[model samples]
Target: MKKINEITEILGDDTSYYLDHVSKKIPKERLQIPGPESVDNFRESDRSPQVLKNLAQLYNHGNLGGTGYINILPIDQGIEHSAAFSFYKNQDYFDPENIVKLAVEAGCNGVASTFGALALHSRKYAHKIPFVVKINHNELLTYPNKYDQISYGTVKEAWNLGATAIGATIYFGSKQSNRQIQEIAEAFEEAHQLGMATILWCYTRNSEFKTDSDDYHSAADLTGQANHIGVTIKADIIKQKLPTNNFGFREVDFAKYDEEMYESLTTDHPIDLCRLQVANCYMGKIGLINSGGGSKGESDYKEAVRTAIINKRAGGSGLIMGRKAFQRPLKEGVDILESVQSVYLNDKITVA
Candidate 1:
């Protein structure tokens, strides 16, 4: 029934309505920092206007673990692996400014990058987005150790760099774990003095600490146990990798398998299982967030989000991902970050 001219207009011109259609569907967001309206209002006030007061309250001036959820950005891979290996393959990622831009664009609560990166990039966006400088780093190219060492950058330096928090990784089961624990304790005290928070990357890694059998690295039971340790040490937030169903505990109490506790703990699926574990861990005071692992296809990323949705539903802080986020093209990586924010804030993973 269409007219010939209409058909010709649709087919011959190559005109497109796709972009316009997509633009209209986008939800209104906190897209621009100090958005246009806020900037206009700011010019009228000297000390503190009502809008600035509201902005401070919304920005979580003093609250980090309340109902106001947290989404952290971690770009520590450059120190975990080698800079050449971690940043060279995707060379644009080597630039510190791009890292900050990606985090802000993705709508994250805060970004966690190494001290060096933050120092280089803070001048531009420190006032715009919150920053967390990772204090310890073990380089693959240097002296090899079983666990990462506390390296450059101090809590004082992070404060100087305008960081909102300081993060460190402590191998829970390593022989040096106690020393790392001591380091964390010291770091916690210092960060608190500066009115900043502390985040810990806790993992059960040595032969002794991991010998618990039921809980160990990558095991829900162990990860949960590590979460408790992080709380005891006063970490404001904690990070762990996704857990597998593999029971690593040494005990063989088969009779207790079908108990209510066990049944309540078990999840409907792997993603749900991890969620259950994090929920179980929430009994402690500290907040728990899962780390984003290696990069994978979009489907795999979505599944990771499905797992995170389970965590958020049951009670989780948010995500602190590295390679899974910044390793790809900047725009695509940001898209993935937005997907995670969608999961955390909206409790839905169906968003593209």
Candidate 2:
């Protein structure tokens, strides 16, 4: 694998520009963790040793091959977005077995999917790789696309199916936010009691959200607050979207944050925007994994690589790529996933 510095140079101009600026500011030790030797310090917490061991197993697997980072394959989109919409391009994934096969073939650290997808083949593949059962999902099939995540299964069911972790989504800005938070918090508490780690998809979705607005749902400020909530709920890992802009101050009147504070703290670079998001995850005590939004034609691979670089450089836990990998052929998907792993494995890329 090429060094991260060299890899940045080969990327297109846009990627190289951000890398050039951010690379200089990265600390000598980019990947940080708790406990001795980068192992997560969950031993001191209420989590059992088995839970810590399972979490360590996930971080230690995959091409990155260590405990300081992660590269998970989340395939729950089949239920979130309709199956036809998610797997239309790659018909092979229509089979639930193929989804597990893809994660195994690609050597992902873990695979996150719905209860049915993982449970149906749990006897065969659950022991082969770390399984993350998505306990809840929001389907778009409903009229006007309701923003609520109904429980698909119980945490105990996931543990019985040999899941190493349990994941759930919470629409932060929606009317059901309070209820979702309460439900997920209780679920995560139960998951911990069962010796399973927890992952929260801390996403913001509301009808009032405007895509063109600077402080929209995906902005750094709001998403950072979402991460804070995830950590408060005791999520072992927090999955969030990459922050595109800083629109957080507009939503509330509690603090008087000016343009100068935003620029100085987050800067204008995309990587810095992501860095701010990580900063909100209990100051990086909890793992922060960014989502791989959607595919962008021929630029999908390049964009994935760029996202990985930014996430890694900004002190993120890793990437939980879904649609970008599964939408393509298995071989192509594996290649893209490997490229993402390469970014984290490259030792020369420094970020403290």
Candidate 3:
């Protein structure tokens, strides 16, 4: 694939590590990876028929459709990062219709955003592309902002807006985590009963997650556990950040884990670390989709392609990237989203 070589050129010296085959700590053969037949796997589970139908609509649209890999555009930052700050790069996004239009033009499988974003334009665009309404957000307007996630709207509200899925975030390690978990679990239950799918932004948040030398929030072991927890809550899809390193527990001298977790089950390799994320999703019974972090200007396209390659090779699902696409001009944003979708559509790129 030409895109593979493009990734090599973009990564430069880091190319070999990103391209290496992952150790068999978690065999790709045993993983239920994304594909045209992936929707069949859900029928065997407890998901309702209507849930299955909505999932089919999600998987069978846009450029990456039927391949089972999903490319979603999440734009809920209005509340999370504030409307003015998030839309500063491109004020066009201030109008919710532009957000949905961008996803459609870019051939994305779905568009995810705040409740009001999808609700206001529901009648016009909901049927054209699957809508994933983020059910909760932590408004930055709070004085001395907190890491907590609170419901911005109800799951039924999202369903009434014609959304196919409901999304929520749980800061898995924060002090208020238990309450967030209970809230999201209850919301997901209501969503499923309402015939909507569920996706969780499984993230770790703790002051101790960082050190002067390394940030352990993206640690393989830690994020992997978050994926397990997300699946336990019956999240139909788990959205996580790509693993950057391992040894979060050992280095932080915190959390509960075993030595073999690092000794035999994992290494410092990016793909292996990501494989651990897939492994924790009950060996791929639940899909693991990585988030595209904030944009990096000229490097956004390359980084987006790089992450898609890593996620696909690691036997995980695709990406739900935002800022990378939304922060730029509309055409450039479409280019960024399509660049990542190219990786998933190319048959030449196989699972590691």
Candidate 4:
């Protein structure tokens, strides 16, 4: 696996852009950043003892294990992005066993996948590594292809399948967001009651979130608010896209926002923009794990390392990367996963 120096070399000239800047707002001190004792420190608090146990299991796995950093392999694309689109290039991934095998071989904290995938091999792999069952997905089969999430299984079913946690997506700002929030909120409560942790794939979907100049779907200010709502529903961890730009609220002129939010709090720096994302995760009490977006070929390793660097410096948790690790041959995919873990393992890559 590569260290920070090797990772920085992969980034080339852009290395200084992420490493040299100091954040202006929400300095890392105020955040309850991840550590080995993260679970013990909050053992007797809002979470049940059983819930804390499972949450700790997540914190203590993978290549980044026991450091309060996590690296998860999420492969629900067979449902969300369609089986053919996700697995056409790599036929090995079509088998659910290969899914679990990849996560284990790649040293992921856990594997998050659909009910069918996990249930098929739960007994064999559940105890070998943590399982994060994704209970909901947006099927593209709808005629007009509406963008909305629906449950594929129940919380009890996931718990029975030996999942340490349950993952779900809420398309915040969508026409059906209200329903999605209510459904996932109740499901999370059930999962917590059953001694399971919960992760929210907090994303924004809506045409209004887009402007000719910028798309607010991945905007820091807007996605930040979406994260606030996710934590409000008591998500133990949040999976979000790395912020692409700021001033989403000001640009859209839809919701209430402060000029200071853009001016005094955040700058154009990637770390600053992502810090706003962490701030909205209940000030890091709820871990903020950024998503590894679609693979762009050739530069996949560099881009994965870059996202990990930005996320770590921003005082966030680790990553839940998928395509970057599974789109190519299994060995190359494992290399990508291990490289991201190396970033968190390097103590020199401190929070900016």
lDDT leader:
4
Q: Give candidate 2 misplaced runs (Cα > 4 Å).
A: 1-6, 22-36, 211-215, 251-264
Query: Per-residue lDDT tens digits of candidate 3, residues 145-228?
Result: 789898888888998999999999999899999999999999999999999999999999998899988999999989999999
Name model 4 segments beyond 4 Å from true. Answer: none
lDDT of each: 0.60, 0.80, 0.89, 0.91
Comparing 1 with 4 on TM-score, the higher-scoring candidate is: 4
Q: Candidate 4 lDDT, tens digit per residue, 158-233?
A: 9999999999999999999999999999999999999999999999999988989878899999899999999999
- What is candidate 2's lDDT per residue for 1-352, written digit by digit as tens? 4466556655856754655554223332443442223445464688888888888777777666564778889888778888988888998887889888989888898999989999999999888899999999996788977879999888899999999999999999889999999999999999988889999999988755554534467878788888998999999999999887775656543335676666556666777787778877866778889988898768887788888877877888889998899898888899888888777777665453
Could you tell me every candidate's TM-score relative to the true structure? 0.72, 0.92, 0.96, 0.98
Assess the local accuracy of residue 54 in candidate 2 as a C-alpha lDDT between 0 and 100.
81
When 1 and 2 are scored with lDDT, the better candidate is 2
Name the lDDT value of residue 226 in candidate 3: 93
Clashing pairs in 1: 73-112, 213-248, 213-249, 213-250, 214-249, 215-222
Mind sharing the TM-score for model 2? 0.92
- Model 2 C-alpha lDDT versus the unseen true structure: 0.80
Number of colliding residue pairs in each model: 6, 3, 0, 0
Off by over 4 Å in 1: 1-67, 143-145, 207-216, 251-272, 275-285, 298-300, 347-352
